[model samples]
Target: MGVGSSSQNSSAMVAIKSQEDQGSAPDLKPKKKICCACPETKKLRDECIVEHGESACEKWIEAHRKCLRAEGFNV
Candidate 1:
């Protein structure tokens, strides 16, 4: 049992080392989710565009664009 466990540990170490060499370590970082990224501007867009008219909501549209850009979005 001890020998088997040692080889298992060695295999695990090999896997981890290979991943490090390939730069494939697990990533736990959070990425920007578009829906949850910007709330205030999203709500503004929803109210202005969905509830009202597009032409009437130009300012809100621009506001949302600026907000998204601030949040690392291309828009």
Candidate 2:
């Protein structure tokens, strides 16, 4: 009975530890990218555009704005 009780307790502890580990993991939401259209972000976006090109940065900014709007944020 003692061995059986100890095994059950260890299993419960393992389950609790697993739940805590999962809760502590970082959220999976997409990170905000540099907005090329905004004056404040223009410099950073320009550098990214220079390296990655105009089309890519423009697409990123547009997508980011759309995401903000979807989230009820007034971008």
**Highest lDDT against the true fold, candidate:** 1
Candidate 2 residue 2 Cα shift, in angstroms, is 3.0
Once model 2 is optimally superposed onto the true structure by TM-score, how far is the C-alpha of residue 39 displaced, in angstroms?
32
**For model 1, what is the error of residue 62's alpha carbon versus the real structure, in angstroms, after optimal superposition?**
0.7
| Per-residue lDDT over 1-75 for candidate 2, one digit per residue giving the tens place of the 0 to 100 score | 787999999999999999899897554443443242344444555577889987779865666566555444456
Model 1 lDDT per residue over 1-75, tens place? 777999999999999998888686444333687788678988888898877789889998899888777766766
Q: Which TM-score value belongs to model 2?
A: 0.31
* Alpha-carbon lDDT, every model: 0.80, 0.64
Error of 2 at 15 (Å): 0.4
Task: Compare the candidates by TM-score and give the number of the best one.
Answer: 1
Clashing residue pairs in candidate 2, if any?
none
Error of 1 at 34 (Å): 1.2
Per-prediction TM-score, please?
Answer: 0.53, 0.31
lDDT over C-alpha atoms for residue 35 of model 1: 81
